[model samples]
Target: MADSTPLLSDSESDKPPEPKRPPRSLDETIERCIGGFGWLQIFQAILVSLAWVFDAQQTFISVFTDAEPSWHCADESVCSSFSNICQLPKGSWSWDWPAHTSIISEWGHQCSTSFITGLPASSFFMGCLVGGLVLATLADSTLGRKNMLLFSCLTMSLSSIFTVFSPNIWIYSALRFMNGFGRATVGTCALVLSTELVGKRWRGQVGVIGFFCFTLGFLSLPVMAYVNRSSSWRTLYLWISVPTILYCILVHFLIPESPRWLFVKGRKEEAVTTLKGLAQTASALTMSFSNVLIEQESLDDNVDIYSSIRILLNKRWAAHRLTAVMVTGFGIGMVYYGMPLGLGNLSVNLYLGVTLNALSELPASLITFFLIGKINRKDSILGFTILSGVCSVLCVVMGRVWPSLQIAMELISFFSACTAFNMTLIYTLELFPTCVRNSALSMVRQALVFGGVFSPLLVAAGRKNNLISFGVFGMAIGICGLPLIGLPETKGGVICDTMDEEEHRQTEKGSAAIPTLA
Candidate 1:
């Protein structure tokens, strides 16, 4: 209070000269990022795409493995001794217990061997649930995206190979769990990496591209399954792991650490060097390295892990968090996991069902790409969730009245549900600001894993009671979309770079009144 003006003037005079700021307009940032790292970004995208493809291949292998018929000898000793011998007649082996003469009959033999073989499948998602939530937070703060990707790739590849040699189901499941933990690391790290490389304008598109690669993985699984159909299941695991291991080697030499993470950690020189390397790889001639200094934004002094959690749970984001949990949990849990298990109960061609389901994801992703720019995200999500729920309810009706239409109903429901699943992935990324983006995303992913955990159990329970499981699932899916009504529309909206800006915008829109940064 005493001579405050003089003291302020003196402090201002003594302060070090401020560094020049780079351009911050949305368009300029987008243009600079595209102009600088466009081609290399595409390469990075492809590598990430392959990683996801392998992940899907690993997940759905159980379906194809179960579809293949197995031979059980009458003599226990013969069965035990000759199990590794590949002498069964081509296409005659059936893993279904109490084999049925009519493959198309509604009461056709359930492939119990696949269930037994795949019992360990849940372990992977369990590992993913734990690892993604806990280890993923370090991706931004300590390890950085590049090293995380490299480590995940190495771990998953080695584990996949180890799974192939698993002496029994118990050993195999344990190995698969390890593989899943590594895969989760890849999923979270890759998304964080891609988003960090671009400015706010391209975050949605890049996130879509990241999920798109996962669908590509689904597509690749069928080809891999078909190729290894004659070989032992262990051989199939080995073949899939090989290419991923090779890619890991390539990642070490090619990918750079995320520049955004570098800037945030006060490693300005490293960030500039990495950006320049990307520009060189992209052959960008117009980029001015000297003009690309990272501009530091003032953040709250109390920033910590707990503060980030509070930010995501604040009044402004509560609806978004709720929508993410409900939609992702129910959509993927019911549709993606439920359909395959249910179909296996009714038919021997579980691979056919899985392939059809995977195929549906392609159109879903394409639709998301086309409509994400055209439609409001909230509306699109609600529309697709409603469509999927209706389709699921229809399946229940079709299964009862016209049992012959069960396959058709399943295929249709899968198509609609997959669209919702893909959109959930895209929309969740769009909902949060950058300051706590990874944390918020990890929270949503944890919900997805929670949902995934319940899917197999629900499908198994549904096999005993017709329509009960699906009706409950449909209700859950439809009800989840109700929260979308409260979420702000984010389609084509530029992502906010910091919490303060997000709060300011929310206040301007009369949504909420959060504290702004100094």
Candidate 2:
């Protein structure tokens, strides 16, 4: 240390200090480019979120289309209001409406076994399950979010239009399968794409926009079904499909691909241009993307279709998180999907009941949007599930003594389930890094549809007994939310863009926990 202060010359010391470099991580770069949650980001999120509207339309459309219309006594002496139409003489009892109004009446499935009546709904969910498994990784790999969203939406819309021409139950069921297969990725892609378009500060809020759009779609169904109460069920398909096709056209023309996806796919230049276009300020536009230093593993130039899924499976922590979320989603999905479909069994007016159930989702979406930052994802989900379960079981218990109290309890139960459903998706989104985010989300949705597969059968059997549908729904959601205890909380945390980055973070945190032996 003899000459420590005399090393530099006077001329060298006179030069200005070098500027410090900005963070090169993709997350930071994205935040810099986005600048703030501006109108551009809001518009982009709305355009992408509109997909969930059509998705919701397709998901609950069957509730009205497949419903069995009211029946009446053709011969007063032979049949009464309480008589079983299946056992009553065919001529003595006739449907209150024309046969063409519902699939159950049109296809002569009213008196058929429950298995036959539940087939179309079950098949649709099964298609979702299979399609999710087959198409899940494509978004994370070659197709990317925008293309996958476009393809899946277009396919779903076209199939829905074709469903209008079905001649029999077999053909209708087959077409429903195709529709479900196509619609499998709609919500997943839309949620992921919309959130990815925004900065971390707005991701959760942006994601909730999709749920609101979905609610609008759900709300629209009851109105449309009421308007077409006496019209053919096929008309509903056309009404939803034509508008969806137009939406697909708009998406194709207006939406930009996700910048994060482009960068990870080794298309850096496109990512930079996309980021620049999203930037509102002149300074952000001028900021160079040249020195951004993402991990090499994130740049997969030729990522295989199954590569993202394989990556998720290979990681121990990722697998555990995936399993936990999926189990929780299954519970939420059963009640979320089943409750509306089973509305016919309730004593209230079908359309009014459906409207009430649809309206219950409004506060859920608003609550999620307004309090997204304050809510703890894991704890909220657990609490909602327990509340939903309690309300659901009470619906059954209270229905015996106070019949009017049943719908109110059911509404609360469904509302709780809806809140839990929204949080589950957003929570799953944050649980994984960007590289395998879509694949993980798709798997969770498949678990959701897997639970829905049994919904129709349960709803059908529950016609005679409420215990089968509502009772099981209560238990499933209550138990499924328990696994969240073992998972880590992600509230107020920065999301990672790469597997290597996330791994390094976890490793460092683990290392920090070890105390010195001194």
Candidate topping lDDT? 2
**Candidate 2 lDDT, tens digit per residue, 1-518?**
57667678889999999975523566677887778987888998999999999999999998899988988888988777546788787799888888899999988888898888888888889889878999999999989999999999998999999999999989999999999999999999999999998878898999999999999999999999989989999999999999988988888888889988887888877888888889988888777656543422345535589988878777777777899999999999999998998888889898999899999999999999998999899899999999999998888887888998999999999999999999999999988888899999999999888888877878888988998989999999899999988887878877777776676666656633212211
Reference-based lDDT, each prediction: 0.63, 0.87
Residue-level lDDT tens digits of model 1 in 1-518: 57655645777899998975533633244446455447777787566546666667766665554342544555454454554424433343334333221121112223334355446767877877777766655554556678878788788889988876665556766887788788776766677777667755556667677667777777777677666565566677777789888988877787778766565555656766776666633434456555555444433223353455665556445445545555655555566666765676554365576677777778777887666667777676677777777777777787778877777767776676677766666676666665566666666666666666666666667766646667666766777667667566666666665655565666667753223322
Instruction: Name every residue pair that clashes in candidate 2.
Output: none
Task: Identify the runs in model 2 with alpha carbons over 4 angstroms from their true place.
Answer: 1-23, 293-298, 511-518
Once model 1 is optimally superposed onto the true structure by TM-score, how far is the C-alpha of residue 139 displaced, in angstroms? 1.6
* Residue-level lDDT for 515 in candidate 1: 39
- Model 2 residue 139 CA deviation in Å: 0.6
Q: How far off is residue 321 in model 2, in Å?
A: 0.4
Q: Give each model a TM-score.
A: 0.79, 0.93
